[model samples]
Target: MCIGVFKKENFEIVNNPKDAEIIIINTCGFIESAKEEAINCILEMAELKQTANCKYLIAMGCLVQRYKDDLIKALPEVDLFLSIDEYDNLWEKVAKLIKVEIKSKNTLDYMDRIISTGNATAYLKIAEGCSNRCTYCAIPYIRGPFVSRKMEDILEEAKKLASSRN
Candidate 1:
């Protein structure tokens, strides 16, 4: 979804962090090890601003959602930090950073998504978050309450994905 929006805005998506002007990392903070790994990755990418072409380093996802305040203080190298719930205005935030005017208000349309995976398969998200609130799981906390997409929206996205392959 993000990649699609970037493409729509004419931003070149680079494979390597060293070559990128803006680097966005979607991290996972489900467990201790994952949190450590995400921190390490963010630190590593933050180094690129000095050593490479990277100017703006943006971090988003569960890690940011969970530890946004701490991360901001701990990692001053990052230019922007966004949580999962902020995705609705993702393009707006990005546009502000890049100094680009938003062409559309509804920039998060699922149909605009670019399948990063191979052509053989595409991921279709039917829902978000979990409501179970299991003791050992942090999903309810990290992702918030469960909310399923409407059947019509799911089917429409499925059709979009299916037709995209052809």
Candidate 2:
């Protein structure tokens, strides 16, 4: 959803993170290792400011939404921390930072993407967030409920993708 929205609005998706001007990390805080990995990745990307052209680093996803306050204090190198709830205002925020007028559609299903796979395959994110509650899980609290897309929208997107592939 993030990549699709960014690409739709004309944001360039660099193959390498070091070459990016604005680095947006869509993280997963599912397991302990995933959380650690996400943090390590953020720290690595944050280093680009010293030697590369990296200007803005946006840390988002489950970790950001769930443990935002902790991350804010732990990682002062991050320019912004965007929780999942703030996705609607992402365009305005990015535009404000880059000093450009907002151009992307905020709707999630639009899914205009830069296909890096070089094939007909595409990932269909049928839902946003999860509602599962485990003994040690933080997904439900962080991601909110598991909200599926409308049947009509899903079908329409499937048809569009199938036709494009053919």
Name the best candidate (by lDDT): 1
The lDDT of each candidate is 0.89, 0.78
Q: Write the per-residue lDDT of candidate 1 for residues 16-39, one digit (tens) a residue.
A: 888999999889989999998999
Clashes of 1: 0
What C-alpha root-mean-square deviation, in Å, does candidate 1 show against the real structure? 1.5
Residue-level lDDT of model 2, residues 1-166, one tens digit each, is 6777777776788988878888888888778999999999998998876789898898988888878999999999988888878887877776787788755556443446445555668665577667777768677777778899888888787777766673
Each prediction's TM-score versus the true structure: 0.92, 0.85
By summed lDDT, which 10 consecutive residues of candidate 2 come out lowest?
Answer: 107-116
Strongest candidate by TM-score: 1
The predictions' CA RMSDs to the true structure, in order, are: 1.5, 2.4
Candidate 1: 10-residue stretch with minimal lDDT: 100-109
